[model samples]
Target chain A: AQSVAQPEDQVNVAEGNPLTVKCTYSVSGNPYLFWYVQYPNRGLQFLLKYITGDNLVKGSYGFEAEFNKSQTSFHLKKPSALVSDSALYFCAVGAFGNEKLTFGTGTRLTIIP
Target chain B: NAGVTQTPKFRILKIGQSMTLQCTQDMNHNYMYWYRQDPGMGLKLIYYSVGAGITDKGEVPNGYNVSRSTTEDFPLRLELAAPSQTSVYFCASSYSLGGSGNTIYFGEGSWLTVV
Candidate 1:
């Protein structure tokens, strides 16, 4: 079974400061991790994904995440936060061959100016 | 591309009434999915179809049913509208990795309320 855990329910960061949203996962084989962002009343938008290769992946909206295999973690990061960055972030994990993806609860990020 | 498109943007149903949320994709994806979003709970998969006529249950599939008659269409039906069924529903489509692409595309979503 594939499972993802986002320990933090909410994250707040000052504008222009770096922000990080933690995510961890457990899966059978090589994990396919993903990050998504949802604005108010909108569907989730894909942020980035780590299927194979580099541990660090860059995504849209100046967002990036690092995949730490030994720690079983994939944490989202932004060099600088903007007010428009405030939204709900989700972490998901899927296996190499499996089509099903297991998502974490979520983390609400607030960029305080 | 239009990616994934869903209909019935907002709807209110009476108890015991039934409704179907329609979804379509133009990306020629083989996999389609239905999911419901709840506050603080993220998104829960209601049902999914690997291809036409191959629907299967997902994490939360109790009160809903789905059908995929064509490669582009996947619809979800709610048998009995209950207050618990009120939620924001999303439809998504994707392809298997190593093909054209691996990213899953999602629709704007449909908001349903049962009164």
Candidate 2:
């Protein structure tokens, strides 16, 4: 079974400081990884995805993630955190051709202003 | 563009009551999915449809039913609503299967509370 684990339940960072949310996955084949952000009372919004090629993938709102094959991790990062960037982040994994996605428990990001 | 739309933004249902959550997409997406989000927990797939007339169960499909009658409509039905069914339901669609170039668009979500 393909699954994703987000180690932290919450991450606190100061505004303008760099932030990282760790994610790890276990899958049988090549993994299709994705990052999604959800604001209060709203559905998730797609941030970025890693399917093949580049290990470092850039996403919306100045977000990026590095896919490490050796460690089975795809951690989301932002050079500078903003108060508006605080939200719930989810890490998901799916098989190369599968349509189903397995998501992590989610990490609540809080940007302290 | 009204990417994906779900009807009845909020509803309160009594135990044993039944209702349907309607979803539609105008993007001509071939794949549609229904998911429910509980407090703190991430979204769990209730059901999914590959295309019109084809549907399958997902991780948490025990209390829900889904139907895909047209390419643009996928409605989820909750039979004998239980307190455990209280959660926000989301409808999503995708043009391609999972992976690159297959980004899923989500609806605003239908918040349901079963007492």
Candidate 2, residue A25: the lDDT equals 95
Taking the tens digit of each residue's C-alpha lDDT, what string does model 1 give over A53-94? 999999999999999999999999999999999999999888
* lDDT, residue A51, model 1: 84
Every model's TM-score: 0.96, 0.97
Give model 2's TM-score versus the native structure.
0.97
* Per-residue alpha-carbon lDDT of candidate 2 for residues A1-113, written as tens digits (9 for 90 to 100): 88899999999999999999999999988898999999988888999999899999999999999999999999999999999999999999988668788889999999999
Error of 2 at B17 (Å): 0.8
DockQ of 2: 0.61
Which residue segments of model 1 deviate by more than 4 Å? B97-101
| Tens digits of per-residue lDDT for model 1, B38-91 | 887878888988899998898899989898899999999999889999899999
**Residue range B1-115, candidate 2, lDDT tens digits:** 8899999999999999999999999999999999999877888999999999999999899989998989999999999999999999999999988433378899999999999
- CA error at residue B2 for candidate 1, angstroms: 1.6
| Best-fitting candidate, scored by DockQ | 2
